[model samples]
Target: MPEPPPTADVSTALVTGGSAGLGQVIAATFADAGYRVVLVGRSSERLDAAKQQLDTQPGRDIVTLAGDVGVREDCDRIASTIEDQFGRLDVLVNCVGTSDRGLAGELTADRLHELIDQNVVTTLLCCQAFAPLLESSRGSIVNIGSLAGKVGARYLGGYNAAKHALAGLTQQLRLEWRDKGIHVALVSPGPIRRDDAGTRYRDRTDATLPASASAPGGGTKVKGLPAATVARAVLACAQKRRTDVILPGYLRLLIVLGNAFPRLGDWLLLKFTS
Candidate 1:
């Protein structure tokens, strides 16, 4: 745990999925910057562990609420709790999402629903519940999206579709809430490396990777950006209120080229894999 800044001004920040991964890092970043952070997650045990880790800094307040953001009532509770306790929200970071790699043909209806509930519905409900508080404070929202949302991938059909919906939602919120003084932005990153990366993706049976995914790496040692890097980018997007941020920077060019020259973009994608 890092120490909060000595002279930093205080504010309130709510981070969903703050128990682990990128969300945890983002919550820590905000706490270090002197915000009273409220962490939301589904697992009480994990939330307790996260609270213990983040509550070390003196004078910095950290609260953890265990609830499913996919449920509307749970989201409402989160909003009410934050409102009664903090009165205002300066930041809202929506990071409660899951990923799955499966071909469209093999994906079951339940799996698709699960993906949507975990990713899109959670985001929608959280934002809807927190909007009034955010509006009161002229706060900012940072929605966690994915690189798959920008460009389609071979075996991530369901996850990609959900992320694409999130991207659209981010844009819609940005447009719809501009007059309300709420800043809305999206952070779309490439694959994030986790501590248990190998085991995390090992048990999946429904998806087969494209040759390109394993071209340079023989095994399942997929390369990815550090979660901390993505966390920093999330803060930057919130502070700057940028509409959309695509990670690695270079991916933006790929998106542009892909849109402008579809066949050439396909050739480039193939060339990279080959």
Candidate 2:
């Protein structure tokens, strides 16, 4: 039988794609919780700006790294840097992902590949590179997912596929790393309320898609969750070592119901979205 995990309190956390958007909010959430936070992203300027924004709290240690985590070399370099600087990592939150809008048939191979790189590859590379450190600390990893990952919704293009792949990867890593004492979890949430929630995907949609298709959750009737709410769930998942969490928690029942009765599931999904 495998031994139980250590009870040491986690101190340091690293969030990938942490320079802006939901990533920055998650970083702030960790910092607010008194964890020494490290934010990684592709743009040095954006990293610097994020650090400034997050450095407001007294005694909050915010470290920013500029690198593309999708690249293995960059992931290796970041891991090495973290080891040399912090010496331990108790939590890793993969908050990097991109959404798309279009019909499944219209989603070209190249576009699908791009979405995969943005959503799946980046998380995989970061998790692979950081596993050693997390192993030493018996840390937790929370991979941010979307509602699209749990159930298919129309007009999301490659997002649903990419997020579904991420959902599978999260579960696989949790099982594979169980003996290694790493807790991997997926926090699949509905469309988050953001400044650009209603129109972020406008440029990605075309005449074939409804204007509402550019809205959050592709015009799904579900309300947008606050960024802070999702961040809190990520924190809870790590601190509690949860297996899987679906936001708007009630959705879990729907997902299960859908799995059990495919026809009813299809009906519920179609009814939920415009």
Candidate 3:
């Protein structure tokens, strides 16, 4: 309800999984907003390409670091690199995550662990490594979450479980880190419109699942959000210090209704995806 926090003093921002997809877009968004942006990822080739793309945009300060944020040691190294070069970090966006395809009933332990590592552990490690810096700068951390985190969507394998864990973790981090002058937020968007949206899960979906299973959000009726829109929301959450944000703001009412009444929620979800 209060006006969003001012971002006038924000100087440097770091984004994990910044080489491609939503991460890259988030990095660009920050850079375009006049912040020095650092991108961390696993592949140098992809990082280089991302840097090149940002370079063509002109007037954007961008740095790319190759490292797996899911690894504690790698995160520590990344934190060190940022400290050495930038001297301070004002924002850290945890954008490293992977979506899944398959029925929850059919989900396997191995698969669930993999989902947690990719969707949750990576953010946890990054936050741990960057806490001191963020504290020093009174900075903000925005974890990119998914709509799956808010509700148990069907046919997403362990993704709903993984994102739900992330949602809980984000809240815990915000409460635990508040006294340290760090603001943590989560931006959970529905299926985002991307170049490979529908086909990315081709290999993971099968006969047991409907043809829509391979689509984004397991073919949820929600329209695909523009990646840029999601990026703007991330920036706003950091600047505004918002708590939990769901894309298509209207869905918040639906989410609340779903949470309060199980039968009605089930019917709504089924209708939306039918």
lDDT by candidate, in order shown: 0.80, 0.92, 0.91
In model 3, the Cα lDDT at residue 125 comes to: 94
The clash count for each model shown is: 0, 0, 0
Q: Write candidate 2's Cα lDDT for 1-274 as tens digits.
A: 9934422253889999899888889999999998989899989999999999888877677888889998999999999988887688999999999998999988899999999999999999999999999999999999999989999999999999999999999999999999999999999999899888877988878877878999999999999999999999999999999989998999999999998999999999999999
- RMSD of candidate 3 to the true fold? 5.6
Segments in model 2 whose C-alpha atoms lie over 4 Å from true places: 1-10
Candidate 1 residue lDDT tens string, 131-222: 99989988899999987787665556488788999999999989999999999999988778766654564456333565433321113222
Encode model 3's per-residue lDDT on 37-67: one tens digit a residue: 9998999999999999988988888888889
lDDT score, residue 190, model 2?
A: 94
Clashing pairs in 3: none
* Cα error, candidate 3, residue 200 (Å): 1.2
Total clashing pairs in model 2: 0
TM-score of each model, in listed order: 0.89, 0.95, 0.95
Off by over 4 Å in 3: 1-10
Ranking by lDDT: 2, 3, 1
Better of 1 and 2 by TM-score: 2
Per-residue lDDT, model 2, residue 99, is 92
